[model samples]
Target: MYHTWMRFFTPSPLHRRLGLVCLGVGLQHGTLPTVGPRTLDHHVAVVISAGSGWYRFPDGRRTTVTAPALLWLTPGVPHHYAPDPGTGWDEGFVDFTGPVTATYTELGHIEPDRPVVPLADAGGPRSVIGRIARAARRGNPLLEVETSAAVHELLVALRRARADTNADGDLVLEALARDACRPLTVAEHAARHGMTPAELRTAVRRGAGCSPKDYLLGIRLGRAKELLAATELPVAAVARRVGYDDPAYFSRLFTRRVGTAPVRFRAQQGRTVPGGWSTRIPDAEHPPTIITGHV
Candidate 1:
């Protein structure tokens, strides 16, 4: 299911702008070594595409390593890592160093404190490493510069790949689905998921093909209809139950959106048609919406 290799690099920087230069590049999968903890003079980024492992830090802090993640081996840090034999990882690594690397750390772009960064784009790191490996193999003129360019790109890719897992739109959708009746603003919903309103809107639009506010309203209306049909709750009670503080406003909105008032809609559902009472909810013109919302 997997294959790999490890390559060492010896790049001579062709220019100063090529701040970060690759020292070595390696690819490994399903391999284990019983070597002791080692300290390196150069920084190495190990991208894991599959399987799991563990990384032991110099401070004696050990962290679990999972696939689709980045394990950063910072310079002068005593660290050791190995793939789980039962589920050895598909790994691609690049050893790099330069003055710009320190700048990267200061900018919080490369988090030395966080050794394990779970990757969001599973194929991204692998692709970067694959490019570096191919460059290393060719041993072309300006290989140093070419690899250095790739090294910079690698860092950027790694950073992008380590997106906040919680900020993902699916989580927001799940939360909204769970409590659509909760009275919360769009900003509050986004904040709950560690995102800004704009970010939440973009994510929701991409994931649900609808605005966050619209989605929330959809869920609220859906829940309100359920309560009106399944329960004996009054109009005002149903309005409040579905997050509307003022029953008059709820009734007006319900009438506008549903093509009928809430009371009449409930009555229609209560009356028997031929075999069953089929009260069509509002928005039949639109496709079924995911009426759930969460931050």
Candidate 2:
């Protein structure tokens, strides 16, 4: 015998264009019945938080599942799994699909080949699943967007939870991100780590799912955006701080990726402190709205 709760969604074509849309979510425990040797048209992430189970491979091999593990059921891929008969398991899963799924896969967030992945902890993924569940309530106006956002969070959580990479403590990624502001090439970065460029590339791919240059650019651009929005520094100073010596080049790249020039972004975001606190405070009842971004 087993216990289960689940909800399914049929999102509109427009919702799907939002990059990642959740199709379903569920919680299951106990000695669940066997699932099919079946195929699907989308993807599902079954986060097993406790107990153990087993799943079948396309070639008919069976792999054992343990607590704090993940099962990636991808589109057009056959899957069959069940919890251990007596001990059973607690599992939370989210089903999602969209154009961004391809990018996530390229970045190694969605591993179709590695169906079962061991996790360092289930707490993070479980939390994201909870968010999806709460957002799944019927007639909720923001259901689609909320759940879709949660799906993105779930992917990051899963990536961080991976037992092997352990993205949170990944020394390589951490070092790269730490030195992201340095004007260094991928090869130079590799040399500093005593790794060949190819080896460093492979490591970054396994840990962060992107090439070294791309990863560094992502970090650099992110910091440039923060400086542009919050700091009073000029564009050239901001560019230098983010490892770009040439302000014009930095502006071009920033505009290409962010779809806006640095000066324009700053204008739109405005200053949070606005030349420090004013001597006169605004009325409490009519306090102005404030906004900020992580990037």
Candidate 3:
């Protein structure tokens, strides 16, 4: 036999529009029998924290599972699994879904092909599950929003805890970010790291889930936005500062990507100081630093 405690929820359309909603959460132990051979309409992250098990796909391939692993049951995917009757297992799970799931999948936060994933450690994911559990309490008015917010944290924790990510890739991403404002092409950037253009693409795609150009453009556009909003810089100057040599090309690119021309965006978002932009507080007047978050 097995033991379990679970709570399911039906969030309002308004809550679902928040981009991720937790549908349920639970803790289970003992030999859990078999599950699914059925498909689900949403996603579920079944975190196996202890014991051992095996899972099967519709193709008849079966794989062994150990503790500190995760089983991703993505939408419309058929799944089947069970805990070993002798050893049993401890399991915690959170069910979630939203349009952001698509983005997460694109970003490699959710893998459709690989369902049974080994994790480096289950502590971070387990903590998020506990938060979801606490928010699932009955009569809690903030249940929907709180649980939904935790779902984002859960994804991030899972990403960080994955057993297979390359540590060296983090260095690549960091270097790219540091050099993002340079007028270097992806090929030039790749050469600086002694990698081919194709290799650079692979590294960037694995780490950031986007191409090198997209990543650099994201940084450039963000810095351009800060300059436009905080300083009275001309659009042409802002474009050149962000590495765009041609003002007309920059304006066109900005307009196409941001849905507004540079001048128009500055007009809408620019800061107008009552005094000149020279108001600076003394270092002694700065607020004290405070560390904060849930325990």
Candidate 4:
């Protein structure tokens, strides 16, 4: 047996900092719309819980995204999609806007001109969205923070999807992920893979579903998230450890990819501050971390 629920959040003038909408649907045996391509007013994260569907973008690119896959919809992108007529579909989705939404928009990851990028593993995201829906239904005060974190998790999943698609891409991404916490360059990575930088870029795009540079940046950003969440390390140190010698540049990249400055992200995670100041410190007891950082 399957059940469905949906929640909608209207923008409140009193609460200017956050916005959210959640939708859950269970089709025992039904069909979705065959509407023409339409643009969204805000960003959307879709998780297919059961059955499968076909998505078509304005550019004519099409992909059959199945259950346990995610769809990212950027505002203003023309897209049209429908569920598999026979199997019907069960899905959950959340739409949100905040500082992080703007950041995603700026990073080009939320492509307004392209179709949704399917997450390799949609289970985590689906679970998070479910939680968000429940929280909203209960009118939880922490909904803003929870929804924001859930969206971040979804974004991280998308980045992993981009890197873990095919074997060749996995090799390049694995190499990048391994060295992301250290200083690494495109040429150096290419040499390690026995290919020129150009060839490596092409290979990465085909295999990982994104360019080599984007893949490396994703790796570094993923690491930055770990330091922000687990350690009291200063943003500067976190930047350096993640291969950015310049803290300011790292801040920009982090804000762009993560939708908040490193300091803010940590604060949102409920870390304590000292006399209104938060300094980053390494965690002695924390185990060696993975690139995903639990996102």
Point to the candidate with the largest lDDT: 2
Q: What's the ranking of the predictions by TM-score, best on top?
A: 3, 2, 4, 1
* Clashes per candidate (backbone, < 3 Å): 6, 0, 0, 5
C-alpha lDDT of all candidate models, in order: 0.78, 0.89, 0.88, 0.66
> Residue by residue across 31-101, what tens digits does model 3's lDDT show?
89789788999999999999999999879999999988999999888999998989999999999999999
Q: How displaced is residue 230 in candidate 2, in Å?
A: 3.9
lDDT minimum window of 10 residues, candidate 2: 276-285
The order of the candidates by lDDT, greatest first, is 2, 3, 1, 4
**Cα lDDT for residue 228, model 4?**
78
Query: What tens digits encode model 4's per-residue C-alpha lDDT throughout 40-103?
Result: 7676766666678798868788888676666666676776877787776767677766555665
Worst 10 residues of 4 by lDDT: 20-29
Cα-based lDDT at residue 19, candidate 1:
80
Tell me the tens digit of each residue's lDDT in model 1 across 139-189.
477778888899988987776677563466667887876666777888888
Q: Model 2 compared with the native: what TM-score?
A: 0.84
RMSD, one per candidate, in order: 15.2, 6.0, 4.6, 8.7
Q: Which of the two candidates, 1 or 4, achieves a greater lDDT against the reference? A: 1
Model 3 residue pairs with clashes? none
Question: How many pairs of residues collide in model 1?
Answer: 6
lDDT of 3 at 91: 95
